[model samples]
Structure formats: structure tokens, C-alpha cells
Target: MSKKWSIAALVLYVVYAVGMYFYIFHGASGGVPATLKGTVADPQTFMTERELYLSDDYSKIRNFLFFVVTPFEWLVYFLILFMGISRVFEKWADTKWRLFKNGAYLFLLNLFTTIVFYPIDIYRYSLSKEYGISTQGFSSWMRDYVIDFWVNFGTTLLIVLVLYWLIQKSAKKWWLYAWLLTIPFAIFMMYLQPVVIDPLYNEFTPLKDKELEAKILSLADQADIPSDHVFEVDMSEKTNALNAYVTGIGGNSRIVLWDTTLNNLTDEEILFIMAHEMGHYVEKHIYIGIALYLLSMLVGLWLISKIMPWMVSKFGRVLNIEKVSDIRSLPLFLVLASFLLFISNPISNTVSRYQETRSDEYAMELTGDAEAAVSTFQNLAKAGLSEVNPPWLVKIFRYTHPPMLERINTIARYTDKNEVETEQQAE
Candidate 1:
């Protein structure tokens, strides 16, 4: 009976996977619109068009997908919970009722910990204790988490409420109209996020070293990137990760470096990292990334709308929810999103890897120091405990950036090419 049920479940999962794939990849009537094509002609106009298209498409699809996948998600969660409880019961000779009781206790315990203690554990054990990283102890970490949770959750709830309101009040062409309504809110969020959202998570202060700041400014000048100041963020509050990024658009744009990164890396290495970030800015990766994600969300929503009815029929009763608006339905939408994303993983990763390679090329060109970049790559790999080499399939399916060895080899090749070109020019 167990084997039979397992087979049945497997068949259902396979069907879901196929349905999800078609829904995401095929549901869109056409590719990205021609108007939205290429890099932004003007940043303001580009942002406007992008937000309009995204808001409209996302609303329609989100409503559809939310209704479709809510039930299946509930079923999966319940099944996993049941199986885990059953295993624990078998070891203790507990009756079915007793097993359930214990399971309920354990579930609540874990949920509470996830809500409360897990954040503390992550900071104390994972972030603060690490060497060469910023030291944020438990109290500070907890304070940050509370602030972040409320800020993020409130923002999300507000967005959802607005979306729901749009769905209920607007006509079928609501998405088109909704975009115009939501653009101001979107822009406000984007602008406010760097100043308000980020400071809640980490301390942002001006980079203090005059000489290093001058060097970075010189590099930025060479790259033709206009920026007022390079600020350092106290990122050691979270983890021992080293990162630098360029944020904002147009005049609002700035460079942010993690304090941990600044502490651990040499000045030249820091320059190379900044160069990589500048490459992202110069290449307009942020704009391109936002556009791609917006498009994906639209398609994903469309697919979800198509699949909800069948999903609800199969699994809705188990969740004790009959309607899509029960709030219980939210998990269902998330599951469908996850399932579709799992299948689309390869395509998405490939796009990211390609962009990363382009950024790497840009960084190398800007820095004119392939060896320094290579060393920085090696150091990052070691510090992060990243696999030195991953299998080809894993690289294709899972990796966002090229593997460490591939990046090193590419840098070496570029260096050799540059050296040969220089010698030829001298002759």
C-alpha cells in the first residue's frame, strides 16, 4: 500500500513538473516587447516603462498562480510533517495518537525556534565567531533581526494588499492600469530602500582611508563612472562574506563595500573588487537584471492562473481551506513558484553566469591586473569554502558565476593575450 501510494505521488509530481514547465516557458504570448529592448535610452524613461509592464503583468499572473498552487503546497508540507513524525514514533514504540501529539509539540517547538532563536544562533555561531569578520554579538544581531523583520514584513504586506485591491477593483485589463498606479510606490521603495532599508541591517559609513579612496576614485574615473563617494558598510553584522556592490541609478548611484571585505583584503584586491562592481554599473547589469526578473514574474503568474483549478481539486481539502483568499492559500502559490523555478533553474543560472563572465572581463580590462584579480578569486573561493572545481552539470544547473578554476584560467588567458598584444605593439 505504501509503495502504491508512493507511485501515485510520484506520478502526480511528474505531472505537476510538466505542467509547470509549459506554464512558465510557454504562457507568455511573446518575448520581451521591442520598446523594452536593449539598454535604457534614458534611465528615468526606462525605469518608468519597466515598472509599468512589470506591475501590470505581475498582478494578472500572481492572482492566477496564487489560486492554482495553494493546495498542492499544503499537501506537500503536511506529508513531510507526517513522515517525519512517523519515523520518530517508530523508534519510541508510540501509538499513532501519541506520535501525533509529539509531532505537534515538535512542530511548534521548531517553528518557535525558527521565529526566535534561529536568528540568534546564526549570528552567534556563524557570523560573530568568524575571524577577520565584523563582530556582531547576540544582542546586536537580535536587534537587527527584529528591525529587519518588521520593516520587510510590513513592506511586503503593504504590497500584497495593494495588489489584492487592484485585482478586486480593476477590470481584466487591470494590469495595464495598475502599472500606472503602482510606479510611484515602486520608485519610492527603490529610493527609500538604500537609505532606510539597508541601514537597518548594517551600519553604513563613509570609507575613511584617503589614499585608498583616492585610488578607487582614480579607477572609477578611468572606467568613466561618475560617483561622489565610496562608502563602507559594516556587513560583519550578518556573515563573513566579502562583497562590494554598486547601487542606485543615475545621480543616486553609489558604491558600497563591506567592512569585512575591506579588513580582509589588500588595497589592490579591494581595487579589483571595486573594479568588478564598477563593471556591473558600467554594463548596466542592475537594470538588465530587474527587467529579466519582472518578465519572469509575469510569465510565472500567467502559468499559475492556468494551473490552480486542477491543483485545488486534488489537494485543497487537506489544508482545511476551501477558498483562495484564506491566507492559507499563500503557501500554495509559493510551492508552485518553487516547482516552476526548479525546472527553470538551468536557464536562469546560464543567464547569470553569462553576465558574470562579462563582468569579469570588464573587471580585468579596467584593473589591468589579471594576476591580482585571479588571486582575489582564489582567496574568495577559499574563504567561502566554495568547491575548487564542480562537475559540468552542477556548473550548468546551479552556479551563477563561473567556477573558481574557470575564472582563474580565463584571467590567465586574458593576461597572456594582453602581454602578446603589448609586445607586438612595442615591435
Candidate 2:
């Protein structure tokens, strides 16, 4: 029965993955309209044919990887579970010292998973290198990869320690307790990420362009964001892609710009982008996002608590998992959580798109420069090689912001509306 279930699941996943690949690569249509010609949003007008080709190639491969990676990771965990590799790690970790035992198990599991996925990581790096998207040397990239591995392992260890402790304390309500603990832990991580974590990979310094800094500070003042610093990160060493963001909370809160952005965009376009990040702050999107995540985690954990036990009851003997609380069952928890998160991508992405739309609108209002807004989007699309309009499934699963086409059109419409209003007032 377990063999049948596993086979059935694999078949379903293969069908779904292949169907999505064909739908995106073959069935997807992104034909441009005649009206878009000569507009800033028009790919044919704006991007060279070589650029367009690279964009299409990168998009297809990226979409394919997105469809494949999570399911493939789940299968890896399932294989480990099925073959009792996790149990082997558990036995090897059975030392007299409790701390040593727990740490050893976690380290072994993390190491195994990281090793298995290293090839995929290298392939991703090679993909970026091939397309001229990444600028980092292989050594620097490997350093970052090592940093990520340790960071992930450390966080996983912490969470597992807390979770298993809770489970042992109260099997009936451990998920509830874990959820409560996660709220503060999540906030704490956000608070520290800007100060303690981000500097590990790249250097960040105060914005060098004092004139532009003053302008950004003025926008921050207008937005009532109490930020005194604008950060400029050295991303030229890593990638050619342009990016900027608002990060941290309260005292740590600051606006960050990639050096590539500063080098590529005009002051006006930069101001529009800065205003958009400020808009996220003014609209309190970060807090709202945290709230939504906590709500989802609350429900997700509760569901896992109910479903995991049932799954163990049905398939424990086949999979070699003794019970929910067994240390060997960590992969099972990860699989369930991953599945839940994957299925919720559309909902989470929709909320993100909505917030981003609001920020784009606020940026238009705050900057009062429709031309800058449209040009900023155009430059962004060009620098990133982003398709103006991706397929709907891509938008649903992947896009946090509105499509480039939608963004530019929204700004154009806003400009037209304002011009009509001005004409009415003059009459």
C-alpha cells in the first residue's frame, strides 16, 4: 500500500510538472498589442532582439526550475525517510550527552540535504553566469553558499529544539505553543537581519551621492518615515540586476539601493523607486505581511498537527517512522510544511501583488512624476530582462508586484486622469 501511494504521488507530480512546463513554454502566449508599440512598455521598441532572446530563455528555464525544485526536494526527503537514512543518522547521534546527540542529528541531516542539493545550486549559478546575470566569481559564490548552509542549519536546529521540546511537554498542544514562539522569533529575525545578518555577504555603506541622499531623505520626510540613512550596497560584485528595498523595523529601518541601480537609473527614476519603497513603509505593508504570515502559520501548524499523526498512523511502518515526536520524523514535518507553503503560494502572492500595487500608486502620488514612474519601470524591466507580461500562472505563483505592463499602464492612466482634471479646472 505504501509503495502504491508513493508511486501514485510520483505519477501525479510528474503529470502536474510536465503539464505546467508545456503550458508555460509552449501554450503560453504573450503577443504584444499594436497600441503598445513605441510605448516605454513595449519590448520590441525597448529591448534588443538578443536581449529578448536571453529574457525568454532565462524565463523558461527559471519557470521550469520553480516547478521542479520543491517537488524534487520533497522526493529527496521521502527517499531518506523510506530508506531509513534518517534513522541511521538518529542512531549515530545516540550519545550520552543530550546536547551532543541533538546537535549531531541536526548537523548530519542538514549536511546530507545540503550535499544532495549542491549540484542544483551549481547549476543555478552556471545558469546565471551563462546569461550574464551573475557577476560573482565561483569562489565568492561558494562562500555565500557556505554562509547560507550554516545559517539554514543554525535556524533549523533552533526551531527543531524548541518544537521537539514543546512536543515532549504537551503532545496535544505543542503546535499552538510553537506557533506562539514563532511570532516573536520571526520578528526578532527581521529586526536583526539588517544589522547582523546582511553584512555577511555584501558591504553596505551610507549613500555616497549626498545630493541624491538629500532628495531621498526629503521623500522619507514627506512619507513621515523616521529614517536618517539611505544605504547603498555593493551589488556590482555580484550581479548586474537592479534592485532597491525598504528593510528592518523601527530604529533599524532604512532604505537600501543596489549600486547597479544607482549606476543604471537617472536621479528621477531613482526617486520614483525610493518613493515606492517609502510607500511600503507608509502603508504599513511589512506589519500587515507579518500578521498575515502569522495567521497562515497558525492555521498551517494546526493542520499539520492533525494531519501528521494520521499520516504516521497510516504509513509509519512502511516509512520506518515510529511516531510524530520521534527525532527521525523531522523530514516528515519538513515535507508537510513544504507542501502547505507550496500550495499557499498563490494566496500569499496575491496579497503581495495587492500591496505592491498600492505602493506603485502611492509612489505616483508621492513623486507626482508619471514620466519618471513609467521610465523607472521600463529601465527595471530592461535591466532585469523581465518579460512585460508573463503567463497568469507565473504571476499567481511568482510575481510579488504587478506585471511590468500593468504597472506602466496604470501610471499612464493616472497621468491621463490628472491631465483631464486639470483641463476641467482651467475651463
Candidate 3:
């Protein structure tokens, strides 16, 4: 009887694994069917004005599949929760029940913390703790958090509602309509984010060192980039991580130097870092990225709408919901989204890795200081506690940037030509 039971358990595990593999990798186009097409609209045409050409019959089928697939995806989350519980019990075998109780307690603790934290903690603990970078403390952090939360929450709700209305009211081409709705919101977010949203986290002060500022501006001028001001961001209030970036689009674009970056890196390293960021702008990577993301989201939403209905019927029975859009049915929707994200993680990582490499190449060309670039990456690795080497498959599937060793090697190959030549000369 025990042997039979053991065999049954093994079979169940195999079935579960097989089901997950298909759900993650094969569900969308492999087994399920859907059609998606984009219109050839004028580049200058506003997204709101464009129409996505999708078949009406396909739309109904897509909605049905979305409902069907949702519950299987939610089961994945249930499995995760179970595995987490099991791991905790294994770690505290002597007090297994106590550990479970503690897990419950921690969940409550975090829930309570969300009421007081979330937006404010973004400043207090995130920005202020960086030694030279962040000067913010508890009181200031609290004030910033509260104001940011309400403002951001209100803005997000407004955007979501507007988008939902656009989808419901506009062209039968929902994807096209959704894309149009996204354009103004995207522009607004880009403009308001740095000026209004960022200030809630850190103080932005005009960069003080005229000489350094002049040097940076000179570099930008030589690159034929137009910018009016450079500002120092108080990132130290939140994290010790050093970073710098050029952000915004068109006329709103600006260079932001993190206080942590200013504190830790040499001017040459900073210059190289800025050069990499500039590469993103000069190469039109930012615009390309935005367009690519919007397109991908449209496709994903279309796919989801197809699978969601069948997912709902299957999972809804468990959740006691009759329809997919029932407010109580949100957990099922969340589960489906999670499954889709997990399945798409590798694809997303590959795209990002390619973009990062291209940007790195552009940066190297601009800075012409491969050694400084290499050193900058090394410093980042040390600061972030990043693993220097990872398995090739792991890196390919999971990494946004190339592994530290690979980046270092690439830079070293370019910078160490003299050492290679010296050996050849001796030979």
C-alpha cells in the first residue's frame, strides 16, 4: 500500500511539472490560437488616433481563452505559497507550527507597515542612508512619503480609469485604442516624473562645482547635445548604490548625477558612466525602448484577453466567481499575469541584454576610455554585491546586463592592447 501511494505521488508531481512547462512555454502560440496586426500609421500620428486592425471573431476567442487560463496560473501562486511554507518548516523543524505562525505574523506586520510606509520609506530608508549621497532623515522621509503616496495613487487611478474608459468606448480595435490612450500618459509621466515624483524621494540641488559642471557641459557640447542644466540628486537618502542617468525626452531631457555616484567614483569613471547614458540618448535607444515596450504590452494584452475566459471558468469555480471581471475575481487575474510574466522572463531578459550591450558599445566609442569603463563596472559589481560569474544559461535567461566577468573581459580586451603588443614585441 505504501509503495503504491509513493508511485501515485511521483505521478502527480510529473503531471504538475508537465502542466507548468506547457503553461509557461507552450500556452500562447504553441497550443492556443490568436491573431494580432498593427496598422501602418504615420510616424507623427498620435497613438490615440491610430486603429489596431484585429478580427472580431478572434477577439471573442481571445477573451474566452484568457478566462480559461487564469486559474491554472493562480495555482502556480498557490504552489509558491506552499513551497515557501514548506521551506520555513524545514528550517525550523523543532518549532514548525511556531514558524508558520511567525510567517502569518510577518504578513500582518508588513500589511500594517504599508499604511505607514510604502511611499515614505522610499525616501527615509532608501535615500537618506547613503553616507555622502543622502542627508535625509526620519522626519523628512515621513513627510515626503505621505505626500508622494496620495499624489501618485491619485494619478495612477486617474490614468487606469481613463484607459479603461478608452478601451470600452473607442474603436473596436481595443489594442489600437489602448495604445492611443497610453501616449499622453507616457508623455505626462516622462515630464512630471523627474520634476515632481523624484523630489519626493530626494532633494535635487543645482550642482555646486562650476569647474566640474563646466567640464561635463563641455563634453556634452562636443557631442552636439543641448542641455541647460545639470543637477545633483540626493540618492544617498535611500541607497548607497551609485548611478547616473540621462532622462526625459525631447526638450525635457536632463542629466541627473546621483550623490552616491559623485561621492564614490573618480571624475573619469563618472565621465565614462555619463557617456554610457549619453549613448542611450544619442543612439535613440530610449525612444526605441518605449516603442518596443508599448508594442509588446499590446500583444500581451491581446493574448491575455483571449485566454482569460476559459481560465475564469476553470479557476472561478474555486474562487466562487461567476464572471471574469467580478471584483472578487482579481486574485485569479493576478495569478494569470504572474504566469505570463514568468514565462516571458527569458524573452524579456534577452531583449534587454542585447540593448545593454549595444549601449555599452556606443559608450565605449564615445568615451574612448575602455579602462575607465571597465573599472566603473568593477566598482558597480563590488558595490552591488553582484556575482562576478554566472552560468551561461543563467546569464542568458536571467541577466539584464552581461555578467560582471564578461563585461570586464570585454573592456579589458579593448584597453589591454598595449600589454598584448608588448609581449609580441618581446617575442
Q: Pick the candidate with the highest lDDT.
A: 2
Worst 10 residues of 2 by lDDT: 1-10
Model 1, global lDDT: 0.61
Those runs of model 2 whose alpha carbons end farther than 4 Å from true positions after fitting are: 1-12, 33-38, 97-99
lDDT of 1 by residue, 274-390 (tens): 988888878888878767766676676667655654565665554333444323344455567677876777888888877887888888998888767867885675445443344
TM-score of each: 0.68, 0.96, 0.64
Clashes of each: 6, 0, 37
Compare candidates 1 and 2 on lDDT and give the better one. Answer: 2
How would you encode candidate 3's per-residue C-alpha lDDT over 1-427 as one tens digit per residue?
3234335545665676566445433453211112211211111111121111111122223323333344444443334233343234324433345334333333332243355335544543542243222355668767876776567546644544444344445424554666666777777788887777777667888787777788788778767788778889877765666788887877767899988888899888988887777777777778887887677767766665666567656644434445543323333444555777756767778887767776677667777787688678867754543444443434554577876556655665655775698789999
Arrange candidates by TM-score, descending: 2, 1, 3
Ten contiguous residues minimizing lDDT sum, candidate 1: 39-48
Stretches of candidate 1 above 4 Å error? 1-135, 167-187, 392-398, 423-427
- Candidate 2, residues 75-165: lDDT per residue as tens digits? 8888788777989999999988656777889899999999999999999999998998899999999999999998888888898988887
Candidate 2 structure, TM-score to reference: 0.96
Worst lDDT window (10 residues) for model 3?
Answer: 36-45
TM-score of 1: 0.68
Q: Is candidate 1 or candidate 3 better by lDDT?
A: 1
